[model samples]
Structure formats: C-alpha cells, structure tokens
Target: MGKANDVQFERARPRIWDRLYPYLSILPALIIIALFTVYPFVYAVRISFFQNLLTKPRSHPFIGLQNYEEVISSYYFRSALTVTALYAIAVVLGVLIFGLGVAMLLNSNIRLANGLKIIILLPWAIPTVVAGLMWKWILNSDFGILSGILYSFGLISSYIPFLANPTLAKISLVMAHIWKEGPLAAIFFLAGLQLIPKELYEAAKIDGGGGWRLFRNITLPLLRPIILIVIVYETMTAILVFDLIYVMTGGGPADSTALLSWFAYAEIFKSLNLGHGVALAIIIALITLVLILIYLRLLKTEEINV
Candidate 1:
C-alpha cells in the first residue's frame, strides 16, 4: 500500500507542475508588480489615515479620515476639483469631435493624404514635455508666434497672456491636449471606419440614404466600441493631466490649473504634507475606478445587444 501511494504522489507532482508552468513563467512580472504598484498603493492607503510629520521622520499618528475631510473642505481643493472636471470634459469632447472630422477627411482619397497624416501624427509622436514647452513658446504673451499673428491681424490692442489668466490657462491647456491627442483619436476612428463594410454604404445609397443618414445609421453603430474606448482613454488622460499644466501654467495664478494629480503632487512634494497627499491620491484613484466601471458597464451593454 505504501509503495502504491508513493507512485501515485510522484505522478501527481509532475502533473501539478505541468498545470502550473504557465503561471510560473509569469511569476516574476507578478512579483515586480506587487512590489511596485501594489505595495505603493497599500502604503498610500495606510498613510492617508495617518498624521505624518513630513520634515520629521518616524512621527505619525492614526487620524482616521480627517485628512480627506480637510482636503475636501479647502477652497483651493474645491476650485481645483471644478477646474479638473471641466478640463476633462472639454478636452474629451474636443478631441473626439475634431478627431472624427479629421479621420473622415483622411478617409477620403484626397491629395497628399499620407503627408497630411504624417503631419497630423507629429503631435502624438512628440514627447509630452517637449510639446508642452513648444506650446509655451508659441503661446507666450510677448513674443509668441500666435501673439504675433494675432497682433498682425489686429485682433487685440495688447498682448494676451494665454497661460496667465485662469480662463485662458484652461483654454490653452485644452488646445494643447487636443493637439496632442487628436491624431491618436483619428487613427483609432480611421481603423474603425475601415472595418465598416463598403457594401453597407452602397446598400444605404441604394435605399436613397444621404451621407448624414448613412453615418447616423451605420457608421456610428459600427464605431461604438472604438468611440467608447477613446472616451475612456481621453477621460483618464484628461483627469490625470499634469505635464501641460506644469509646463504652461505651473498650476499658478492661484492654483487655477491644479488638477487632481497635480494637486496630490503639490501636497506631497511642495507642501510636504504626506498624509494629505496620500489621501488625495487615493481619491484620484477612486474617481478613476468609477469612470472605468462606468465604461465597463457600457461595454457589457453593447456586448449584450450584439
């Protein structure tokens, strides 16, 4: 009986290893992720409920959710939150609408279409920091190319500070975002557009469907998945915007352009409030999760309909 049991155990050991081999191959990546992403996340959550002295080490007290309450109640946080929400919405809408228009244009067999596409893709290919810097130069109040052009056209009497004023700062940031992401969005839309059957358009034409009608009936329905993906990506990108604002406004003019990411960063590094920063970071993560959940729900509905 002992010999028989030993043989069975030996056979099962190899079978178990065979079953687990694939997972074992990915174990290193899983370990790295746990060490970096998961550890930091857990640490942040722990610190969010603590009162930590930034300048002094090894001094922290558990304070429940007071940091969250303080961050929520602050006027600076409230205003920045509003600006962040508006910035996300505006950038997403502008990128989608403008990108769709550009995609439609590129889909046509126009002259220099490839060249145009290459030019359009420049923004997406450019490093974000470089793009922000270039725009800062162009949007500078005194000697910016745009300011010069506007001056040449006699649009305004004095130089307009695009990044100085709160309203103008938001507009400038949105414009930068559109320039950076529009081409990427167009590429996605173009891919979706190609998958749409040419026969569908022909059929629509046979039924006396005009351009608008065909687009409304066929193009939109077919492109819903790509559109949803773009929306999700754009939303997350906009919410987490930091580079543009950092380069352009520096979250200045009384923190007008302070997005949630920037807000958390400012709290941690600038103000040296680790606890408050961690709390804000957690809030940002939660908001992002909520947005993702909404997208997943919509995706599920679309799948069910299909």
Candidate 2:
C-alpha cells in the first residue's frame, strides 16, 4: 500500500507542473515590462498635471490642468502643429513611393540586384544623429560634395546654401529623412511582395492583363495591408522627428522644421519649462493614438471587404 501511494504521487506531480508552466514561462518578461514601461508611463502622466521645473526642482505643486492650458496657448504651438502636419504628409508619400520602387527593383532578376541588396541597408544601419551630421556636411554651401559636383558639371554657378533658405531647408530635411528611412520601408514592402502568390500574376497575364493592369488589380489589392501599416508608422516617425532636426538644421531658417516633438524638446531644454514640455508630450501621445486608431479601423474594414 505504501509503494502504490508513492507511484500515484509522482503521476499527480507531473500534471500539476504542466498546468502552471505557461504562466511561469512568461512571469519574468511581465516583471521586466512592469518595471520599465509601466513605471515611466505612469510617472509621465503624473508630471503632465503638475508644475515641475528643473530650476525649481524642490517645489512641484499640483497645478491641475494649468500646464496643458499653457502649452495649448503658447505662441509657438500653432506653428509647430502646422509644420508637423505638412512634414508628416510629405514624408509618408516619399517613403511609400521610394520603398515601392526599391522593392520592385529588388524583386527583379537583374545583374546589379545582388550588389544593390548588400548596400541597401547602409543608410538605415547608421545612427540617426550620425546620418543627419553627414548630410549636414554633404549639403554645406561652402564645400559640400554635392555642390562641388554640381558646380563641376556646370549645373550651377556656385554652391547653393541648402540649409540656409527656408524652403530649401525643408526640402533638404525631407531628402535626408527619405535617405535614412527608405531602406527599412523597402524591406517591409519586399516582405509583402514575397508573400504574394506567383500564380496570381501568371493568371492575370493569361487573362490578357498587361503590366499596369496586373499590378493595379493584383499587387495593389494585396499590398493594401502593408501600405496601411507603412503609412501609419512613417507618419508617427515624421511627426516625432527630433534628432535629425537637432543635428542638421537645429530648427533654423525660421523654424521651418520645428516639428511638434522638436518643439517639445526646445521647451524643456532651451527654455527650461518642464511643465510645458511634459504637457506637449502628452498631447503628442494623444495625437499619435488617434491616428493609430483611425488606421486600425481602416485595416479592419479592408479585411472585412476581402
């Protein structure tokens, strides 16, 4: 009877462990996320409601919604909002078009495609600050490589100041952004393209569909999901662009590239108004959340249609 009881205990022990295994496996990650992500988010939310300044660090009085009100009424807020909207639109379009073109080139069986793949990630692999500084020098008015090339080829009489003029500074920022971000977008598009069945293209061709017809009917419809994701991601990235503006133009040329995120940084670091900075950050978070919700709705609708 003792031996029989021992055998029964061993079988029950295996069953009990199996039931708790999934939760046990995930416990460490949950603890880490709670410590890092959850804590900071809660702290920021608390800061947004109070008057917290580094200069007056000892006194953090709870001002209710005063910080939010001040941030909204600030002089630069409207200008920053307008600039951010325009920048996000331009960057999203540029990234999508550039990425799609590269994805097509990569998908084709060309002689240079292999060489192209090896170098495609160089722009994205580098740090954003390093990339911005490199572009700053490359577009310098006095001794830029691009200006030198253009002058050498007789395209221009002299080197143009790429980041000195308001319009040119905006254009230069977009160009630099596209160069740095286009590679990752290309990788995403390439993944989507590969998932498409070859039989679909062959069937379209057999049905008398030409190149444009095949792409419009098959590729575009199938790529809709990826396009939605890319647009949303790129829009968020553009709206929050800071490091490039910080390193390259420094929001110069009359604040042409003073995006909302950069505006928040200036408020905190340059002006030393931590309350305003935190308030702006909270507003940014809300804007981003709204945009994400809209895109997710569209994605769901597209799925239902399909």
Candidate 3:
C-alpha cells in the first residue's frame, strides 16, 4: 500500500508540472519586461529627486526635489514646453481634419481604392528615422529638389533654412509628423467610416437631409469615438517625438527646437549622467501618465455612451 501511494504521488507531481509549464515559460518575458521597461521607469522616478547631470557625475549627491525644481525653474524647459504644446496641437488638429477629409474622399466609389490605400500607408510604414532623414534632405536649403522647385517658382529670395529658424523649425517638425502620421489616422477614420451603417444615411436622405447637414449630424456623431482615440494616440506620439528633431535640427540653432525627449536623450547618452537622465525620463513618463489618465476618462465616457 505504501509503495502504491508513493507512485501515485510521483505521477500527480508530473501532472501538476505539466499543467503549470506554459506559465513557467512566460516567466522570462515577465523578467525582461520588469528589468528593461519597469525597472528603468522605477529608477527614473527615484533619480528625479536629486540634482544630477552629465558633466560632473562624481560630485553628485542626493538633493530631494532639486531636479524637479530646476526643471520647473529653467527658462529653457518653459520654452520647450510651449513649443511642444504648439507642435502637438497643430499636428493633432491637422491629422484629424485632413485625415478625416481623405478618409471620406476614399470611402466613396473610386477605382483602385486598394491601390490608393497601399500608397497612402507607405508613409506610415516608413521607419521614423528614415522619414526624418528624408525630410531633412527635402528641406535642405541647398541642392534639394524642393529648394530648386521653390527657387524656380520665385518663392524666396535665397535658400531658406527651414530647420534653422525657430518658427520654421517647429513647422517643419509638424509637417514631418503630418506626413508620417496623417495617413495612419486616415486609415483609422476610414475603418470607423466603414463600420457606420449605410441604413442611417439612407434614412437621413429620406428625411431630406443634405450632404453637409447629414455629415454634421450623423457622420461626426458616429466618428466621435475614433476621433478621441486618434487625439490621444497622436498627442502621445507628439509628446515623445525625438527622431525628426534629432535628424533635422539636432535641437540646434541655439537649442530652439530642443524638446523634452531630446533633452532627456542629451542628458543620458550625450552628457552621460545616467541618474539625471533617468530623472528627466521619469518626468516625461509622468507627463505621459497624466495624458493616459485623460485618455482613460474619455474611454470611460465612450463606454457609457455605448
């Protein structure tokens, strides 16, 4: 009886192991995420309490809230915040407006719709670094195809450095973002447009609703959910945008285009202050967190409506 019981217990142990094996396999992924993603975030938050930077790492010491204070006190930070706000607002609005327009246009009876979609998606599919480099060349003051065209059309006195001037720098960044992100937003809007029941449009027509009126009343209302999602998504992208600015201006022309992300990047890699870099990163993450909370609220409202 004792021998039989021991064999039964051994068999049960293997069954338990087999049942738990899949979850055990996922432990490595969890560890990687924790180490790379979660741990860095946690460390950044801790680092934000001190005054640290790249130049003098050896003399660094803990000064609670000093870095945050410095960030809030710095004129450079304020200017970057203002610039970033304007950039984000412009891109979000443009992407939504122009994207919806394109989506509506393509939703109609058009030949080669699939081909058009593939073409439009090309920009979004392009890697961000490559897009930035491509645009840098396009906006180059000398020997660029765009510059030559503009010169031929008598649009300017001479080569205009789009990435050099602060206003134009911001505009160039916005244009780059629009080119890359607008089509993606349009695709989302197009999906939403397709989901809308045609019967509603037919009913509106029966009631003598015209195109403008029908769109204002029906289409906009239906598209509200998707619009909210796109706004949140685009805003986050704009907030953390680094590639274009890095490639085009390098936050140059006297740091006029230095965004928060660029600032953090410089601190981390350029300046080699790991702790302070981590701190700046934490602040950025907090900003992102706030934005995410706002998105969650909007999502809840959407669910209530549904």
Candidate 4:
C-alpha cells in the first residue's frame, strides 16, 4: 500500500508540473517586458503631466493638464501635424509602390533578378543616418553626383538645390525614406508572393489570362493580407520618421519636413521644455495606438473574409 501511494503521488506531481509549464516558460519574457517596456511607458506618462523643465531639473511640479494645453496650443503644433500627415502619406505610398515593384521584379525569372535580390537589401542593412547622408551627398546642389549627371546630360542648366527648396526637400526626404525602408516591405511582399501556389497562376493562364489579368485577379487577392500589413507598418514608420529629416533636411526649407517626432525633439532639446515634449510624445503615442487598433480590426476582417 505504501509503495503504491508513492507512485501515485509522483504521477500527480508530473501532471501538475506539465499543466504549469507553458506559463512558467513564458514567465521570464514577461518579466523582462514589464521591466523594460511597461515601466518606461508608465514613467513617460507620469512625466507628461509635470512641469519638468531641463533648466530647472529639480523643480518638477504636477501641473496636471497645463502641459497638455500649452503643447496643444503652440503655433507649430498644427503645422507639424499637417506636415506629418502629408509626409506619412507620401512615404507610405512611395514605399508600397517601390517595394511592390521590386518584389514583383525579384519574383520574375528575369536576367537581373538574381543580382537584384542581393543588392536590394543593402540600403536596408545600412543605418538610417548613413543612408540619409548618402542621399544628401547625391542630392547636394554643389558638386552632387546627381546634379553633375543632370548638368552633363543637359537635363538642367546647373546644379539644383534639392534640399533648399521646400517641395524638393520634401520629395528628397520621401525618396531617401523609400531607399532605406522599402527593402523590408519588399522582403515581406516577396515572402507573400512565394507563398502563392504556382497552380493558381497556371490555371489562370490556361483560362487565357494575360499578365495583368493574372496579377489583378489571382496575385493581388492572395497578397491582400501582406499589402495590409505593409500599409500599417509603413504608415506607422512614416508618421514617426525622424532620422532622415535630421540628417538630410533638419526640418528646414520653411519647416517643410517637420514631422511630429521632429517637433517633439525640438520641444525637448531646442525649447528645453521636457513637459511639453512628453505631452506631445503622449499625443503621438495615442494617435499611433489608435491607428494600430484600426489596422488590427482591418486585419481581423481580412482573416474572416479569407
């Protein structure tokens, strides 16, 4: 009877341990995330309601909604919001178009497709600042490679000040952003493209489908989830764009490139208004969260349809 009882206890212990194993396995990751992401977000939220100026670091007072009010009522807030919206739209469009084009090209059996697969990721692998600077050099009005090429080809009379003009600066920023960020989208799109069964394409072709028809009816429908993902990801990235504007344009040329993130940096560092900066940051965070939630609903709808 005693030996039988010992074996029964041991069996029960194993079952109990197995029941808890999943949660135990995930515990360490939960701890780390709580320590890093959760703590920082909570702290930022706390800081946003205070009067924490860098010039008076020791005098952080709870000002409640004052910080929020001031930041919202600022002159540049509206301008920054408008610029961020336009910039995000341009960037998301440019990245989607460029990435989809590249992914389609790489998916093809063209002669240059293999070489492009290797080279397409180079810009993405490099740092954002480095990519921005490289583009800056290429677009420099004085002695820029692009300027010189255009001049040599008689496409222009002389060097073009790309970064000094408001419209051109915005365009250059978008181009640089596409160069740096489009590769990841291309890779995502390529993955989706590869996952599409070849039989579908073959069947569509047998039904007298042309290239455009096959793509429109079969490829596009299959790639809808991926396109949705790319749209959401690129929209967030474009809204938070900062490094390229910093390295290439500095939000100059009449503040044509002043994104929300750039505006936050200016508030914190330039204006020495930590409270205002954090308030603006909170607003940006909330806006992004809303966008993400909307996208998630769209994703769910897509899944349901599928």
Give Cα-based local distance difference scores for all models: 0.89, 0.91, 0.84, 0.91
Residues 186-253 of candidate 4 have per-residue lDDT tens digits of: 99999999999999999889999999999899888998888989999998889888888899999998
**Local accuracy of candidate 2 as per-residue lDDT tens digits, 188-279:** 99999999999999988889999999889998889898999899999899988988999999998888778889878988998888888988
| Ranking 3 against 4 by lDDT, winner | 4
Number of the top lDDT candidate:
2
Pairs clashing within candidate 4: none
**Highest TM-score scorer:** 2
TM-score of 4: 0.91
Model 4, CA-based lDDT: 0.91
Answer with 1 or 4, whichever has the higher TM-score: 4
Residue lDDT tens for model 3, 1-306: 255578878788889899999989999999888889887766667777665665776666788877766666666678877777787899999899989998997898888776787799899998898998998899887766677788989997688888878888778888988999999999999999999999999999999999999899999989988999899999999989998888888987787778888887887788676665666667787888898898889889878987
Clashing pairs in 3: none
By lDDT, the candidates rank as 2, 4, 1, 3
Give the candidates in order of TM-score, highest first: 2, 4, 1, 3
Point out the higher-scoring one by TM-score: 1 or 2: 2
Measured with C-alpha atoms, the lDDT of residue 98 in candidate 4 is 90
Model 3 root-mean-square deviation: 3.7
Model 4 lDDT, residue 120, Cα: 90
